[model samples]
Target: MGNQVNLEEEAVGRRGREVQRDGEKRGLEGPKVLREECPSSRDLLNSLRQVEKMLAVHEASYQQGLRSLRKKISALHNSTMAIFRIGKNASCPKPEPPGHGRRLGRVFGIGHEVHFLCKPTYELIGPRTRVCLESLKWSGQQPMCRRVNGTSNSLASFSPAAPSSSSSSTSSFPVSAALSASSSTPASSSASSPFTLSSSSPTSSSPSSSVRPSHCTHFLGSTRCTCDVGFTISGRDNNICTDIDECLLFPLGQPGRLCVHQCVNTPGSFHCFCPAGYDLARDGRSCTDIDECENRMHNCTVDQVCVNTYGSFQCVTVECPQMKNATYIKTSSMRCERNPCMLGDKACTQAPNSISFHFLSVVSNMSAPRVLFRVSAARVLGDTLRFGLAGGRGRGHFSVQRSGRQTGTLLLVTPIKGPATLEAEVEMSELERNALLGRYLTKVTLFVSLHEF
Candidate 1:
């Protein structure tokens, strides 16, 4: 029995080797072979069961790992796609074509701005700066710069006239004498008649043609009556004429007004007149505002602003903060608040030089709340200052006006939810001969806390 078992075991080993070789040729992992054979048939059956159990456990672990790897790869691919989408959406639009005016800036991307400049003799008709919006479009239409019309009295030189009434005659010359006169007479003598003549000679000397009425004239051998000024020929035979009212024909139209503010029709012509605060334009038919401010004709004080109205102007006083020992005064260039600090006095160091603002609650629209503040310094030469927000939480919300060199107004806007804090910073620098003298810094903090009562 022992010999028989050994022979069987050997046979089994040989068969296992053949199977492993076949699996290797096919690029597959082959099953492991047992080094020792079972002593009896019952032992062999038990060993086979254990080996099957181990193989099942390892297969389950491999499937779980494969599923985990697939999930990670899918997540990475989705992240990459999301990044590409954002890069594509952030692209800017193309630049517009050049117009009558010159553009100051070249960058035309989102949130960028461009300024327009007209020539010396031209005037701009729209916003000075156009900004690119988030919608991939410009905020407003491009402006146009057109030459100013200085010679307002030269309208007659460009005005259109009737095709038949270019030249005027004295109306005293007889049509028959013009026809009977020989070629020796000057062409100018017969051409004086308002009616255009095709030929100087009469076609026929019949009595009916020569006996025309006094009011009628002969042209092209045909008798036609002449119309008075402001009248035109209207009858079918072109003999009878009717009165014409020039005021009824586009008297109020732009560039072709026959009257300024009011029109009066006369028997042979029309007259134009203007209303109060307006004077007749150079064309003598339109009304233009009489600029009291431009002509130095205003009665406003030096500290008042001459704001031009429709037909007149208003004098408005400059607004100043209500503070102790501070008075508003008007200089040659601008209106400013005068304090001891403005005189370069050392007493300014003891006075309160900082201002504080508090906001306990905000409106419902917190997405973009606009807050304004003003900062003023002594009018000193070569002294400049810059204002900005320093905190990372609300840095995007602050914007300062760049126009005022010494005194300026700062604006803050931001979108917030719940409670937030803002920190503002102001930097001051002094310079002489374009060389820096000293630098100073100031800070202010604002706490925004809202309660849902």
Candidate 2:
């Protein structure tokens, strides 16, 4: 009985070895061959199990043979399981490519990677590359290619908000470590092989575009999407938020606008901007006129007076005129009063008795035929005054017209582009029936600014 059991055990062991070798060879033939041959290998193992059960009836007599047969069966079962595992891990499911982007590497075998690239003017929103894992899953999240918003580049005035805590630090994936720990097969070992999808021909498939951002927070049994400080919720979905164009919402010319001069729209907020001669106020939503004269920001010389305007400043120089028989006294920085002279002095009566200086600042290329200055007699009792433009560098651009019996007006006929200094003198003669009694001259200085307020 012992010899019979030993013979049966040797035959079974020999058959098991042959089946193991065939299974090993078939497993090398790829997953398809292993799948087709796996059933036969299982049937052979069942036959060996039956033989071991039949010998178990004479357990004490054929203990060695039974033990040997069981060992062979165990070895064969382990080999089959290993082969099955290899076949199962042969490949992973192919992942979908991102929209407006192209993917490389068609082979979906374990440890294999696929690279993603965005089209021109589009941005990649997720991982650039993904690797296949032993669990038959792709590493990291699926990537996407989104359209690049023109607001990012065109709106250079936009100030980006600080990064959130979750996005402040980047975290790296442990794909390589995971790959190393997974069981290695013939396909997995050569995972570095060149198996790339065509990147030259980009896919033209269109995907659903997101209109708003997806940033949500959960609290008190409720979930809400929150945008940045300057952003607000958009649409009825309540899952996303979009940027608020404050500049468009509150325009410059509108009554309740944010800025006094100009409003610049950012991604999430808006910025107030003042014109050339103004500054942004402390409130950040309004603009304040810059006091160039008070701040000493004017370029006036030491001999010139700095005068502030609506949005600019002007520098003017006033000096008492020197004439024969005309002694002038300084009444103010811009006024010159004639000293009392003898009534018989003809030169003093002929020349101007009082001369004053006036300064004005205007923007470049102002409208034509604007009344710039008015000259009126302090007191008049049926007295006539003749007003005319005296000889000066800026006489050609101005004209003096008699407005009333004792009043005259200075008209700017031509607009001047600046930064330039225009000097014009207005001579007012006190007359009684065409006879000149006394004369008064006024020097007018116009400071044309380079910028239009």
The models' CA-based lDDT, in order, is 0.48, 0.64
Per-residue lDDT of model 1, residues 1-453, tens digit only: 999999999999999999888879665432223324325687888999999999999999999999999999999999887755664355346545335556644566666766554554444545545777766677777677555453422211122122232232222221111111111110112223334322122222321221111123344334534433333444344433333456676456455656656776553346677766578787556677666778887899987767554355556554433555444343323333244455554444333333332222332225544645555666665644554443333667666565467755556666544345565654455566765544333343434433211
**Model 1 local distance difference test score:** 0.48
Q: Write the per-residue lDDT of candidate 2 for residues 234-287, one digit (tens) a residue.
A: 544443434556667667666776666777665444666777777777766555
Candidate 1 vs. true structure, TM-score: 0.28
Regions of candidate 2 where Cα sits further than 4 Å from its true position:
1-264, 275-277, 281-287, 292-304, 310-315, 339-348, 381-383
Clashes of 1: 0
Candidate 2 versus truth, CA RMSD in Å, comes to 34.7
Candidate that would win on lDDT: 2
